[model samples]
Every structure is written in C-alpha cells, then in structure tokens.
Target: MNLVPLDLDRDLELLHAWVTHPRSHFWGLQGADPQRVRAEYERIAADPHHHAWLGLDDDGTPLFLAETYDPAHSELAEHYPVRPGDLGMHVLVAPPTRQRSGVTSAVMRAVMDFCFAQPGVDRVVVEPDVRNEAIARKNAEVGFVEERHVTLRDKVARLSFCTRTAYAMSAPHLQPAAIAYAHRRLIAKAIAEFSHERLIEPIAEGTGRYRVGDLAFTARRYALNHWVVDADSLTGPLDALDFIAGLRETLGIPEKLLGTYLEEISATLAGTAWKVTHRRESAAELVHADFQTIEAAMTEGHPGFVANNGRIGFGLQDHEAFAPEAGRPVRLRWVAVRKDESLFVTAGDEREHYLAELGEPTLARYERQLRGHGLDPDDYRYLPVHPWQWEHKVTVTFAPDVARRSIVPLDEGPDRYRAQQSIRTFFNVDRPERHYVKTAIAVQNMGFLRGLSPKYMQATPPINEWVRQLVDGDEELRACGFGVLRELASIGYTGDAYHRTGTPGAYTKMLAALWRESPVPRLAAGERLATMASLLHRDRDGNALVSALIAASGRSAAEWVAAYFRAYLRPIVHCLLRHDLAFMPHGENLILVLENHVPRRVFMKDIGEEVAVMNDQPLPAEVERIRIDVTDEIKELALFTDVFDGFLRHLAGILASDGVLPEREFWALAGDCVRAHAKDHPELTGRLDLLRPTFKHSCLNRLQLRNTLQMVDLTDQAGSLIFAGELENPIAVFG
Candidate 1:
C-alpha cells in the first residue's frame, strides 16, 4: 500500500460507510469518527503489542491492512502463554474492494507468517463473526479453523487459529508479479542451454577432428554427463586450421606473411576415427585412435593430495609430489587414477548421489513432464565429453568388433566425483555457523555485453535470499562487498526528487517491500576474512611476511602505516580481488593489496585444506549440530591453477634481484595492516605480535633463500627490501 501510513480519518470514513450501509458484508460497526479513528490508530501505532504494516500490490497501490498480535510485546505483558514458536495476525480489506480474491487472504497469511518468522512467536489467532459465512470460508481457505467464540468487551466474536504447519494447506495469496515468473522462465531456459551444451548434446561436432555424427549419432556415451557434442557443431568448418584462418581473415589480418603469426601445436585428430555401430544407447561408440600423446593437460602443476591443490610428478605408475620447497622430503601416493585421467573425479561417491539424487527415483517424479515436453534423455546427455574421450571417459573404449556385438549398458555413472563426500558421516563440517545462518550472493554490478560494448546492470540484491536462510535454512551470503551502493533514489540511481519527474516514480516507501524482502545480508565475513588474511600473510617461504615485520617493529609505527592503508588503499584492492580471489592472495597492487587483506580479527587462522574444530571449552555436540547437516557440504573451489609462476614464487626473485622494497618498507606494510582495524577491535590490534615471525624462525623470506640476492643500496633505510632485488630480470612478473 505504498508502505505509507494510512490516512486514519479517511480510512475510518470508508470503514464507517461500509458498515452503516446495508450492502456491507464483513463490517457492521456501530460508530467511528475522525477523533476516534486517530485514537485507534495511535493505539495501534504506539502499541508494542501490535505490529502493523500496509500491504501493496505490484503497482504499489494500497491493497489491504495487515497487522500482527504477538504475546511477547512489552504492552502485552500479561498476554496468554505464547509457545516458543507462536504468532497471531490478521488482515482487513480496504473497503470498495469487497472481492476477497486470494490477495487479501494471502495478505492475512503473510502477516501471520511474518509473526511466526520472528525468533519467538509461533501460533496466530483471529476473531470474526461466525455469521459472516463468506469470511468464515475465506479464513478456512487461509488455513484457519474455527476455535471457540468468546465475549470480549461484551461482544461475542468467533475465534480462529492458524499454525505454521497449516499455512501450506492454505493457498498463498502473495506471490511474485507475472514479470518475475517470466524472468525465472528465461533463466531456466538459459540453465537448460548450459546443461545441454555442457552435459547433454550427442554426436557433437568438434572444431578439430571429424564430427561423430558423420557416421550417424549412435554413440554409447551420449547419455553420460560430460562432453556433449551439439549436432550443430558438425556443420561448421572442418578443423582448427580452417577456423583460425577464417577468424584471422574476419579480424582483417594482413594477407602478407600471415604464416609467421601462427604455429601448429599438434597434428590433426582427423587421422583418428570413431563410429557408432548397432548401439543400445547412442552413447556407445567404437573408436580407433592413432595415438601420439595421451596425457592430462597440466592445468594444475600436478596434485598428489588432490584435496590440497599442489604439484605432483609421475613416478612410473605411482604419483610423487615435487614441491622442492617443502624441504626435507616429498610425498608419494600409489593411487591408480589421477583427477585429470578420470572422466569423473570420483565414481563411488558422486555415483551414489547421481543414482540417488537425480537418479531414476527422482527422474521418475519428473518423467511425466519430461515425456510431455517430448524430451529424449539419451539425445540430450552427451555434451561435455571430449570428442575423443566421450564414451571411453566413463567406461572403456569400444572396439568395432565389440560395438558390433556386445549390448552396451546405460551410461550410468558420476560426473563430478568427490571421494571425500562418499562417507555418510562427513557433511557440513566445513561451515561452523551451519545452523543459524543461511547465505546467498548476488552478482552485483553485472556488466555484460549488450550488443558489443558491455553495459552495467545490478542484480536484485540477494538480501531477500539471505533473510530466507535466516528464517528457514542454514546457509548465508559470505561474499564480501554486499552493501556499498546508495538506495536506488538519487540521480544515477532513482530520480524521485523532481516533482513532475517523480510523480510516476519509484517510492522509497514502496521499495521497502523489495528491500524488506531483499535484505543485504551482513557479510558473514570470517571465511573471506581468513582467506584474505592468508593472502596478506602469504610469503614465498609459505609464511606471513607482514607477521614477521610487525614482530620486529613496535605497535605504534604499525598503527600509523595501517592508518594510511585503510584510508587510502584497501577499498580498491578489495574490489579488484573479489572476482579472481583464487589468485588475489598474491601481492597484486604490490603491497597495496597485501595491506588490504588485513582484517580486524582472525577467528580461524589455522584453517587449511582440512577442516577442524577448536573452541575454548570443547562443545563436542556443537560440531554435530543441525546447522551442519547431511544436505549441506562445502565444495572446494581451489581446484585449478591458471597461473604459470604464481605470486609466492616471484616475490623472492623480484625482491632480491633488482626491484626489492627496503626492509623498513616491509615493516611499514605490516604496520599498515596492524593499524587498519586497531581502533575498534583493540584485542586484535594487540595480537599483532602473534602475526610476526623471527628471522631465525626458519619460515623466512622463501623467495630470498631460493636464489642468490642482488642488492642495490638505498639511502632511505625503509626502502632496503625494494632495493635488494633491483635486477633487470626478476624471478616472475605479474602476467
């Protein structure tokens, strides 16, 4: 209702008109006046017992009156014994709108739901005359049942009650506007396309090599959940060579000496051939490869302990890690298959989920819709499989003889297999705040290519999703930088200040509906704080450089430096690192970002690849709390390394060769971090000592020790670290 306070006198006149008129249905009030209306409204407005708000339709018109009566209020001090989960609420339609079309019923239900949604109230109560047959039916439709009638203020009224359990039984009145449904449908279609492109298309044409559909789309792995080949790809230019030449020509490549710009990486897969013979499922295909190289792409250096993203080398059939920096000794494992070699990462765990979750049991429920929509699952299932490894990835390679003879089984296996998730016990331990907080993230400032140039749009903030989590789930939006923008009101925002311009404008009051439902959640900043801190402290030596500096210098100097950083720097680094956080831990803005990663407090510093618990007095049961339940498990995002040398490796060469900052500057950066949050969180400020390490502590400048030092004498003692590595060629430069 525009969220504006009701015009009490006007509303009273309208109500009085309805009741006194013989045509009135719900109300038959004896009397009401301007003064009486003001007095009643004041009582409601001021009454702690009553929570009153107006309901508005999609167009922001006032729809009805909504208010809740909860027993916990200070005014309702002697109110009846309210249960741990209980609430009461009601809705009165604005007169001249006698149609109780689901909206009013929903309004009443929403008020009751809001009451129950609060931490305490649970049950809702309403009273109406039983003789009003229409209202009785409406209340019943809203999951309200007739209780006993009571004489209150010497007036008999039939009482009714509603419960959370019963709200679902009632039809919901409040709903997303039609536009929202349209948007959701659009999004769903996009998701469908991605699923089809990445995990469903069969007989897809490869840019290199011939299209599998050339021999008819009878591949056995067509139903598998990887590398789906879109049949459309079959019609494109034959190979990478053709595609590249055409691309260059379109980009206006000079005709002269075009050959000098490009080089062939590998010979064509055209020589290799595959065909689908009589197949049970189209996913089955027999392939013959004239193999040259069959090794996994080194996306990561090579991981031995797959859980920890690290480098590993092949030691015959066994795997050995070559971290040369880990010192002492390197570890080796005898696992049969590495992550890259396998079509799916894990077979047992993810297979269990696939078979149980989106498996037949689940698919059956949606099969009618599937069939009704004319979906052939097999045709839509082979998208993400590499052209060569499509079927062989999940099962075994099929020879022409076997393909012609053996009946292929359905492609039933896992795609993203995680061994850690196989166990029934291990779940949700990753998030300590699993019970109370529900989280979501909005991709803010969404800049996408509208035509050619990218245009900016904002996501409807995920605050509503966050509020839902707090009310119904355990997740939360831990993403940083959630609410820095102004309300959509000002110019460049919402132009509601100009009278003529603002007349048909967005109202802050009405926007409250969106804002109320969509609350910008307080970033549950601990994990991000921890990750950022780790990045700041990350030294090539695998220790924190900022920590070491603060230990050497006293707190006061650190305070001054930290002040400059917070005021002049951190914000920029925070914004930049947000997207590529996996790599941001590197000192990107040089020491600028390192200083920004500093946080006010460090709750979980010991956090690493593994999860652990460390509370003062061990809350044994707390670890198994409902928050971290079976349905909730954290997925690791540190699976890929899209970097060549990495930040840690380069720091030493850069510092020691020709471009090192002075030792004093190092301390200044550490001091800057210490001072950033010193004022408000003094305890954390005091713990600056805990951050530092002694030079002799062995976890010293890792990059420095890795190579010989090249020093350039600096007059300013603070710049010594910078001057040390003043080499024309440092170890690694930021790419």
Candidate 2:
C-alpha cells in the first residue's frame, strides 16, 4: 500500500463517509458532514504537530485513513508523559468490503509501518475508545500494551502504546523473515570463507551438495559463490558456538583462538540480530536514498569475513550507539594533553587553525575546561577521544595520566560525528566540510586491537603529504581524478609515566587522534561519494546496490564495469607497476566518486598505515618509513591477491548471481584494464607480466581463525598474511 499525504480537498467526502460509519464510531466523527471533515483535515494539514495519510491499495483505491500526531502537542498531552520518540497515531480501514480474512490485520500492519517510517518515531501511541472491543483486540494483535483509561476531548479512551521492539515481536512476518535472511547469508559466508581458509575440507556427496567433517555436516550451493549449511546437519539447533565446537578437531583451531573467536562470532550474530530487528527500509527505498543513508542501510557487513562485526568491548547498548551499523550520530569526547607529553603534526595548518574549525564557542569552552583545572590552555594540545574509550580504557587503563593531570578530560565537542565503516574514524556530519577525526579506542575487532599506535603518528602527515605530492605531479593520475583525503593533522599523547618500556603500548595508544581532510569539500559539482564497499552490498531483501547503480547510470553492465575499472582498477595497477607502490586497497579503504550514479573517480583513504613502498624501493628520507623490503616474488600479490581475490572476485560473483553481468565478462573487463595499463606504460611490461600468472591464494579468514584476539602483528602487517595453495587466475584466461 502507498501512503498519500491526506488531500483535504479531494479526500474530504471519502474520509467523511468512512469516519462517520458505525464501525468508526470511536473516532467520534459519526455525525460529521463533508464540510466538518474538510475543516478537521484542513486543520491537520496546517498543523505541524499533526499529519493525515490515505493508504491506497495497488489499484489506486483508497483502503484506509491514518493520522499521526505529536503526543506532547496532541490531545494526549495532559494524559501521559510523552517520551522523546513517541508519536501518536490512529488507523481506520475502509468499511467492510466483503470482509477478506486477513485484510484488516494487514491494513493495520501497513498503517503502523507508515507511522514508524518517520524518523525519531520509536513508538506509536494509540488511544482507541475504551468501549471499542474489536479495535482493542486488533491493537493487541500488533503488540500494543494497554496502560489505563484516559479522558480525551470527546470520549474516554484506553491509552495504549507499542514500542518498536514489541511490534517486531508481535508482528511475526518481520522477525522470522529477517532471521531467515540473516542466517542464510551468515551460513553461506561461514561455509565459503571457512572453506577458502582450508578450515574445513568438504567432500562432494552429490550435485550441489557437500559433506564436511562428518557425513551429517552437509551444505548445498547457495548464492553465486557461496554455500548454505543445512540446519539438519547440526546435532541440535543452529548455534554458531555449537557448529564451531563440532568442527574444532577437524579445523585445528587452537584452544585460545577458538574461545576468543566464539566471542567474536557471538558478537557478530548479536549485531545481525539488532540490524534485522531495527531495519525498516526496503532495498528499493535504500537505493534512492543519499550516499550516507545507503551506507548505513548496508546490512551484510563483509562478503568474505564471517566474524566481521566483532566489536568485542561493545555490549548491546554500546553497539547501538557506537557501531557504524547503528547509524546514530555521536558526539566525540574531548581531552587536553600537556605539550611536553604530546606530539602534534599537521600537513601545513597549525593546531590553532584546526581548533578554529571547531568554532569559536567550542574553542572557548575547551579553554574554560582547562582553566577550571588550574592549567594553562596554551601549554596543552586538544584531542578528541572516543566516548567508549574514555569510559572503559582511559579512565581505568590510563588512570595514571588522568591522576597526574597530564591528560584532562574535557566536554563533548559540538559536532555530531558518524562512525564510518572503520569504527574509530568519524565523519563530521554536523559540518561536512570539517576534517574526519580518527581516534584510538582500545577495542578488539576483526582480529586486531583497533588502537592507533602513537609511534605511527609522527610520520602520518608526511606520508600523506608525499602521496598527495606524487598524485599532484603525475599527469596520468591528475587526469584520472586520483585523490587522497589527506591525514592532514595528527596528535598522540605519550605519558612517559604510563608506559615505562618507552615503546607505545595499548595504554599509550589510547589517547592519540588524527584528522583527515573530508571528501565532501573536494567533490565536483556533479559528483557524489559512496564507500566502495557498497559495490558488494546486498540489502536484507537480497537486492544489490551495484545493480541499482548500474540501472541508474543507464549503461550496460559491461560498460559500467569498464568505466569502473578505468577509474578504480587502472589507477592501482599504474601505481604498482610504475612506482613500486602498493596500497591495502580493500573495498572499505576506497571511496567511489560517482557522477549521476556512474563511476567518475576514486579517493583512497586509510593511507597513514596501509600505504607502502614495495620491493625495497628507495623513497625520500622523510617518507622512507613507508618502504617495506619484500622479495620481488611476493610483491605482485599486492594486486593479484588484494585487488582481485580480496574484493573484485566477490563483486564479480554478486553481479553474476544477480544477472547484471556474466562472471567471465567481469574478469575479462578486469584483464582488459590491466592490459591497457601495461600497454600505456610499455617500459614496465616485464614488471607487469611477472605478476600475471597464478599466485598463492591469500586467506583473510585464516588470519582471524589463527588468532581472533590479535589477528595481525602491527609492526609487520604484510608479514602477517596467511597463504594456502595457489588458484588459477580467472583473468589469466583473458590474456
């Protein structure tokens, strides 16, 4: 059903007939005429506190009348204390047209859905007449909890309310459907990723069916490149812990990693449950939303990593407020660090310039906070801290710094920031032009303690500035719109008293922050930005964001793929072969610049840590820290493993599964991009060709499977990779 804003002029007569009927006597409009209905609806349309909607069936026939109002401003004001998210609503279906069995119930559900769709509406308040037994029974069916009788303008009413959670439970279709969808998707990922990691060897039992560990543990082909583990294969219910326990011996996961991994898996499952329960938008609706909305709507966390959302320190409440999936804007907690114990670096701007961006009022307030503690504001540098870190880590773990007055906690900053897919990094939503603030939070997620190392902060701006200079000087890169959201400034608080070892530990990293330039200010007039991760996104309804983009671009899938390669893949290839440079160019690390939903350019981020100079290449003295000495044989996996197998392989599978493009065509396009880049730089032919053959498959899950607590060594990120037997490159066929 489509909800049309109540047309007071056109709907007056129809609305009068329905509300004045004996069935709608509780509505208190029984004796109302057309003029009276018009006056009432006109007043509703005029009032900001109230709204009326007409629900129409598929054939454009009016089926129901719904009214949504602010409980605080409406007739219910004095009767009850209105909550922040409470919205008053009433529903009346068109009188008995041959009384279909479930039609009334369905209409009620639709009305409630329409009401809850409005932002800030967490609960719906309804005050049906106390005498209306039928309406009361119908309300209870949808999870309404009756409180007490209350006197309204015209009649005594039963005050009832239905929370979002209550409605999700009472409305069976949503929870069951979401659970089935989430479970199927998660199971498919576990089977595929675990299999790829060689954690479980599956023997083919029959067509599209395979058995793993035991004959009873079986799975069938699921999506384009994944599998669905059968529920019946499990000894009992489909619990992730139980499933892992069953396969522990076969997979050879250590006792230490296994227990930590289970905690991660449990957290992942909990996140999925929250997402499924809270989601209201359909895939189509999400497709039409703005970039950030589409980003927040992405429910499938990662295509390959099964325990992708293991925010270990986050409980349910913390997850709801801080997780990127939660989509809630957060205010960052601020702190002042003494100058002697802190290091502040910037691209060109001074600390004062960055502070000015926080607005004069916020700057004054921060200064006042420092002065209140009898400290000079000039002697300290200000840094934003994650609220969770302040509550859990900084307060307890770094108590010495707090006690000595080296690190003084300040007030919350003015801007509302949104947690990007990388949880610690925050986008300034309150002022989009402001730089992104990346803070250190001592939390374990996706196999790493996600704390920013204070040691790395010294070289952060220099590394980014070097990359910016290279891109600016290169004609090809400049022409292709290759850009970086520079980590313009960084600050790390190193309290010597806290870490006696002189090496930065978890506690030392707890108070550091870096600010990167926002991509929003750099966007051209016609261009919009979306995270490249959206390419692999499939909504809860299994609709693809990439497919939607392709449709909106009005280009053939192959044409769109070619354009995307030219903009995204070609740049990475050029950098690797021509400059001996490699980036951790995974999906989340790249931002897609789209012009009318078509790929226009690319913005690479997370560069302070992920960008590296490969093959012992000499860089300038200041930026030489980025250089990593890897053998020539292992160098090419930068493109082959990270670009192809890491991201595009899964993308190709999804596009193929959705019938947007054939799997072969997708790789062929990728191969064509590499060939074109090689032909353009004939001097680098030998270097490029050496990387074309089959390479050892890089197993992402293997890293986490081996050590979920700390997946990779921060000191040597590349050395932490786990590799299995080689797989023939799909693009090799194109050559």
Q: Point to the candidate with the largest TM-score.
A: 2
lDDT of 2 by residue, 90-151 (tens): 88899976524345666777788787888988999999888899989879878999999998
Task: Write candidate 1's Cα lDDT for 470-493 as tens digits.
Answer: 223311112211222111110011
**Which residue runs does candidate 1 get wrong by more than 4 Å?**
1-31, 71-84, 97-101, 171-735
Query: Each model's TM-score?
Result: 0.24, 0.81
Number of colliding residue pairs in each model = 71, 1
Candidate lDDT scores, in order, read: 0.28, 0.78
lDDT at position 207, candidate 2 = 67
The lDDT, on a scale of 0 to 1, for candidate 1 is 0.28
Task: Name the TM-score of candidate 1.
Answer: 0.24
Whole-model lDDT, model 2 = 0.78
